[model samples]
Target: MDIATKQPGVLKPKVGSRSQNIMASRVVLTVLMFALGILMILPFLWMISASLKLQIDVFEFPIRWIPENPQWQNYERVWAGRYPFYRFYVNSIIVTVGATSLVLLTASLGGYAFGKLDFPFKETLFLSYLAMMMIPPQVLLIPRFIMFNWMGWLDTLTVLIIPNAVSAFGTFLLRGFYEQIPKDLSEAAIIDGAGHVRIWSRIIMPLTRPAMLALMIISAMWRWNDYLQPLVFLRRVTNYTIPLGLDFFVQENTAQMNLIMAAAVTATIPLLLLFLITQKYFIRGIVLTGIKG
Candidate 1:
């Protein structure tokens, strides 16, 4: 009848052995995860390696992980603009900053309107927004290009920023966050003579810093990585974005893989830093948004 000796309804664990086994499993998993993280970073290692290599060493069969002579000048050469690399960096910054700014502002306002206002056709309007989201950017490319031409905006920053200024995804995301705010909060603000704009700026804006940061990371990454848009809109070498910059690197260099990799590594550094900085907020946003609406 004693609990220590009896098997009882459920068998008891051997406390010391079980604890050790769990600790051992955790240690193994920790090591495995560490190894996988290294594997993910391996290509970056090789990229840095190949960037420093000479053109011949790049294609060499037995690849050295590090160049015999670390070519620090490779970074300098990307800015040298023998191939418009610097130009492309400028172009990318302009488009990215512009597009991300527009996306954030427009999405925030649109999301607030949809979430807080009970205007006529509100449901229909949101559905229409959702419908537009379904229509892939590629499908709209031709019409958008023509529209830009009509407005004389092609190859201009306006052409790039205006099209992506409002994102349905952002609207949807922020609207969900907005809904989490009680109706009484906005009502009280209004009763205190706060206009919608005033409320948005003073009240809602301060609360949604994490959400905005999360949105910025998403939008910035997309714009930074987008190639097809830049390829289509920017025809001149001087107007190229980073993706286009890579193309010019190869074309101008005549298969100078070292320089190309060098330029690529240079370009990737910003995005990597971006990811590292906002990674915590980005993941937190994702997890928080999964809660029931």
Candidate 2:
């Protein structure tokens, strides 16, 4: 009985020590993650602070997170400057919305077809489509520019919208999500005389809301912040999107750090708002994709 009691006492301390070690490791990980988060956000915090400080105060020796006298007029100057700032917002919204909508429609249809339907050369066609994603977008710039020039689409919003409308990444992402869905759902609908379009619209589409929302957010961010394509395809001042317009603003106001930061903040707000609003679905979609992948 003494030996048995001594064995329990030895094992209890070992188990307690193991639990304490795990708790210590967890605490350390939490601190490390918190530090990394602050490190990553420092640049953005500086941008916000600089936007509200005087030009001289922007890069002061001792950084001030909050200025004694915040320059509220910096934002006013950015918006009311000689350049048409609002026009950039309008152009960006138009291109982003148009491209994102088309991405959703095409991705959903393509994902459904690939995941649910089988036809001649189904695998071959998907592989070929997937191959396109391997090509660097810069490689297509010259050819796309030539084609757009020939078609008289240069310097027009159509050039922006049409090229970005179809997304290979979205199709791939949604296809992965769609494959995880039970095939029985589609089979059941088919037995009831439902067609592909009907089954996709009424059933599969609703179930993949997380994936679809994730695609929308990703597509919108891409189109909204695209710079090189807009720079190459667009020439007119009025046709300039936010990225191009911001470049022009920077060039004109190079010496004015406050106004430049203010412009950057203005351009960044929409994206921040979008992510904040859809963050839950966005994270869920990413997790599901990883799990299904």
Candidate 3:
């Protein structure tokens, strides 16, 4: 009648029969992943092929998988081509850096304040930010354009850079990250006579590098590839960013599909490089933020 006297017949096997099922599942997943990888790589392969091809080879009856002669000059041509792709690149870099810096500064401050501080109407203020997320960017486009025009910011760099600088999505992401910090840590800092600024500078920001990188990637990607905003804001061709500049190549090289693909491929490399550099932090930040939020 004792618990220790339990019979072996009542005991289940130590190893379950699910090993076969699990192995089968893994095999299926591997196949699925291989297919997905090929799918994702096709466009990039085509782009590179197009970038290297002669204008005629791009539209050859049997699509050329590899260029017989790689026009290494195509890259140089793209740099000096149509709308000054080099200038567009510089402009995109400038705007991307500025926007990313602004997002990091404001979102880190805003997220820290919301997550840690206990001021009046704090929840309400953050709720307002969350509400803004529901409002689609397209809905505010016309009004924002009008306001920027009134500010005499139309066609200016600020017209492109400032509006996207402070992202609600960034703030939302960082606030969740900030909340994950233990209150005891902040209290200890406070007990040491540390002000909010000291605690944020010394503690919060360092602990949230992943979150900051996420915001940087988000802000940079949006700013770099921002087509509609630049298209509408940049009236003059010389001031265009890569996305807006790409349009010129598309139009001018319409008959030369290879050249257009070359331009498209060129426009894409910076973003790919950016992602490659920060891929670890970017992916980790997203997964952690989603779990925490």
- Highest TM-score model number: 1
Once superposed on the true structure, which residue ranges of model 3 sit more than 4 Å away at CA?
1-32, 289-293
Candidate with top lDDT is: 2
Which lDDT tens digits does candidate 2 get at residues 1-293? 33433445566768776556566667777798999999998988899999999999999968989998999999888888777688899999999999899989998999888888889999898998889889999999999999999999999999999888887778888888889899899899999999999989999999988788778766787898899999999998789999999998999899999889999988887678777897887677666555643
lDDT of 1 by residue, 224-250 (tens): 788888777766677778887887687
**What TM-score does model 2 achieve against the real structure?**
0.86
Quickly count the clashes in candidate 3: 0
What's the best-to-worst order under TM-score? 1, 2, 3
| Of 1 and 3, the candidate ranking higher by TM-score | 1
Report lDDT (CA) for all predictions.
0.79, 0.87, 0.80
Q: Tell me the spans in candidate 1 whose CA falls farther than 4 Å from its real position.
A: 1-13, 285-293
State the lDDT of candidate 3 residue by residue for 66-133, as single tens digits: 78999888777777765668888888888888878988898888888888889999878889999998
Clashing pairs in 3: none
**In model 2, where is the ten-residue run with the lowest total lDDT?**
1-10
Against the hidden true structure, what lDDT does model 2 obtain? 0.87
